[model samples]
Target: MPYSRTDLKLEIQTHFDKGFSRDLKILDVGPGAGMYGGLLSEYSDILDYSLGFELDCLEIYPPYIEKFKLKEIYKNVFIGDICTFNISSYDYIILGDVLEHLSIDNAKKVLNTINKNNQKCMVAVPYLSEQGEHEGNIYEAHLQPDLTPEIMKQRYPSLKLLYGNDSYGYYVNYNFNKMKETLVIEYNNLFKKPIKPIYPKNEFKVNFIKGCKFEVIGENKNNYHVEFINQKTNKVIYETDITNNMWTKPSLEYFVDFKIRITDQNNVVWENKFNAENKRVYIHFASNAIGDTLAWFPYAEEFRKKHKCKLIVSTFWNDWFKDTYPNITFVEPGEEQHDLYAMYEVGWHYNEDEDIDYNRIPSNFRKMPLSKTAADQLGLEYREIKPKLSFKKNKSQISGDYVVIAPHASSHAKYWNYKGGWQTVVDYLNDKGYKVVMITKEPMYDDWHDSKLGGTLKGVINKTGNFPLDERANDIMNAKALIGIGSGLSWLSWALGTPVVMISGFSEPYSEFEDCERIYAPKGKCGGCFNKVRLDAGDWEWCPEHKDTDRHFECTTSIKPQVVIDAINRQLEKTP
Candidate 1:
């Protein structure tokens, strides 16, 4: 919606003034961030301008998404390419100097799509131009240089040409004043209301084998509408407002596809598909993060053996879920039909002021591994928490028996070896005649600290790369034992049936692991500040108490190398 007044932009603004009313929805196709000129700035000078009418924008860059989101300027921002995404019908779909950036075929496709959708089209491109890309995306390099008014007219004969220059290809002008008198009524018929937002709490849930229900706990529930969709047939099976604080589910026998669409008063729409089956009862795991998702596999395994129904996991890690459990169904959160779904919740942020919400999380839930806690809460026959990957074993980098020493973490504070502690561990393992493999994917990973593992100790392997996550999971499973921080591998190794020596820098031992030796920083001294509220482990940022301490990150530095070695020895001693 925002644009700067380059001469071409001004001309486009004049066309809007000449034809469009404030009511007709206008779309700016691939409008460059217009960093220099947001919406109103195009009509006036840069010095004084204010955002006026709500505008729609389609941008691809993430930074731009955040910028527009924070600006709250646009009614909606579609974070995708105009070519691939659906080009809906609009009163005015302006291509503000945007055509040259796309391949000729893509540009033609967009123009054809808009035309087919019966939407008004505007064009602007550089004639016979070289690569003139704006900032950020490299693919933004201009591709259609030979774009000219003659070519556009030939491609789209019905288009009425306004002005064309060697610099800017074409502006297909519309005599909106004449259209307002003649075609305004016909055009307004195509106008759509503004989109709104709704909620089931999360993005989507899949396979609500039956139907889902909601209980809106707040007054804002009156402002939104919840919808259930049959995915395969594209049917709205149910939709209603939560005025009574009761979101009851509709009786659905069997649905091939399941989706939830939430629309708010303003017409904003958010839809997500959750995997659901009509006949089978399913397990609903409450999580969206990878670590939390992986923690549920043990329960899934036990649940699978006991029940004939499939496991329905609600998480964002769809591919990971599918790859991990070929038979299990994965869905986004909140799409589960509560009438069919039996929610398995571990924790929620400390937000609800009522007792009802707090009652959902089982007491002492945070005190033990969720696998055991959940199993006990459900009164299921408790089995040893054995998390094993269903995927076949992957090849290892080193052939011989090796103990993986994971030194890298999401943050430096979680690391046990900031000051030569890991060097001692690797050297300790090397003397023990066991190869030490270090695997990591932290982009900000420093190597100087790992100078000793510089492929010098023929026994040490640095298996770090941008490889698939499965390979990492497989490595953890096959390793003799894993000596790592409180990371995904730490969780995976334990679940994959391999013993783990867990070293914690920012968390307590009870909450994360059991049946294993754990070394943690004392809470009084920068330790165990994790839960829903204080979620992040050190990501180069420090916990408040440890940030500027005279001890220099004593939380992690406090753990001695021998402590890790002893833990590893204890685990290895029990192996086989």
Candidate 2:
């Protein structure tokens, strides 16, 4: 039997691993592309010591000789007919398919000339013959008759036959020395499937869902050992009886990839990679905060254009974005189906002990505002992100003409603490003839303690805690300008295209808004502490004890009330 190139390589490694020294001298009569020699070289690298392929070659084809030179597999190249090539002593010699192209008389002469030493040799002759007339070289056509195991033995009686079969031609020892155990392998069944011909130890990729048929010749199709490995976890996920050609690729509902291996009792026959690239892909948006949600909108716009993906997001800010970005097919968080990437792949793991590489996540998101970072990392072109929200004018949220002031934050640290900060601005705006309307949210308000944020003012429309968030949003849209601390309402003010005077020491202006009047304390290292949200950074430091003192608003306490009053005035002067 004619042995496969891989089968020959495996046999060489298995036999040599048992006893051969680290150094070897090999003769290859025809080493096209060095595929066999390359495999042998790689296997030698894996050994504790090196097995140098100090190789000698006998090939007449000029193109292939140059190809071998490029492969760097052979130590010396001798061009001529093997029949007259200078004979040399060698540790191991490979005939490959060289004998098939020579007349039977010449083939026998070369074999006999080489066997004069009883040196180890591997011989292969194709059972089904083909005149592979390569590159217009008529001399390369097969000229010898097919040689069987019985015939091969009869032709060289002095040579000790180690292994021979109809499928793979034969192996022999010239010295007729102590017989070494020979390794045999066959794969006619697998050859039926149109796998790109490969040397040993190369990977093939397959669809995880549409698996493949793996039936070696003569073995029952269902009798091979199969293994499915989860690539994400690097763990064996499945092992059992395979239905031969009927083995369907298993599904990874949560995981998107795996490494699949097929083997018989002796060795691994084949291996392949299986990833979710073939499956449907879904990108999930799970954050509920309005600002955070909209930040990802630009990413969505570019993602839809780049991939045939399903967008799975909540209805939190649906009205503001649904019409702006129509390609997105929104879904409830629980209803999300992940075929490709998912939010959980990048989220902060709750368990600290679990090792996960955040930088390895395949998404565009990072922990920063849109002004500071791109919405996605995968280089998708997206529209520039500026404060954006779509809504119409509603005058009822305010009485008569007015300027809006929204001054509340979720935490006290983000609260502007300059004494009379808002009150001073309110008095100044009132003096400028612009009626001031200070808006506040419910329950968080209720007490009508206007003095707490700044101070209560007469003639200032105190719409404190009265309007729903929707009404407040509309009111912001209608207002000539809005002034507030760094809070959701400040975000709303900018999103609605209304001019805003944002005051906070916790974050820098460049890190938040693209165009706006930013009032921040610049006196301390604590400036822009909002970006340092790490737990160890301590809750966005605020020296509230110095509220009435000069230290208030960190370094920004020096920004007088007139500064903000003038900023609001300038905004009112502009044409929208």
The best candidate by TM-score is 2
Q: TM-score for every candidate vs. truth?
A: 0.45, 0.48
Per-residue CA lDDT of model 1 for 1-576, tens digit only, reads 122224444334334444556666767666554432254323333213332445677776656555333245456667787888766746667786677677777877887787777777777666666664455466567676676677767765656766555556445534444644434443344333321221112222233333445444422335557777766568887887645345546554322245677677858456666532333444555555455666655666465555545556555555654765676677776674444443444333233552323334334454455556556433355555655455567787678888876656666556673466766777888888788777666421355544422323244576776657778877776788988777777777776777888888666677675766788875556666553234454346556565665665677667777777887888889876
Cα displacement (Å) at residue 449, model 2: 5.6
Model 1: weakest 10-residue lDDT segment is 195-204
Each model's lDDT: 0.59, 0.57
Question: Best candidate, lDDT-wise?
Answer: 1
TM-score attained by model 1: 0.45
- Cα displacement (angstroms), candidate 1, residue 331, comes to 4.3
What candidate 1 gets wrong by more than 4 Å, as runs, is 1-288, 300-311, 317-328, 331-347, 352-360, 364-366, 372-384, 443-459, 521-526, 531-533, 536-539
Quote the lDDT for 235 in model 2.
86
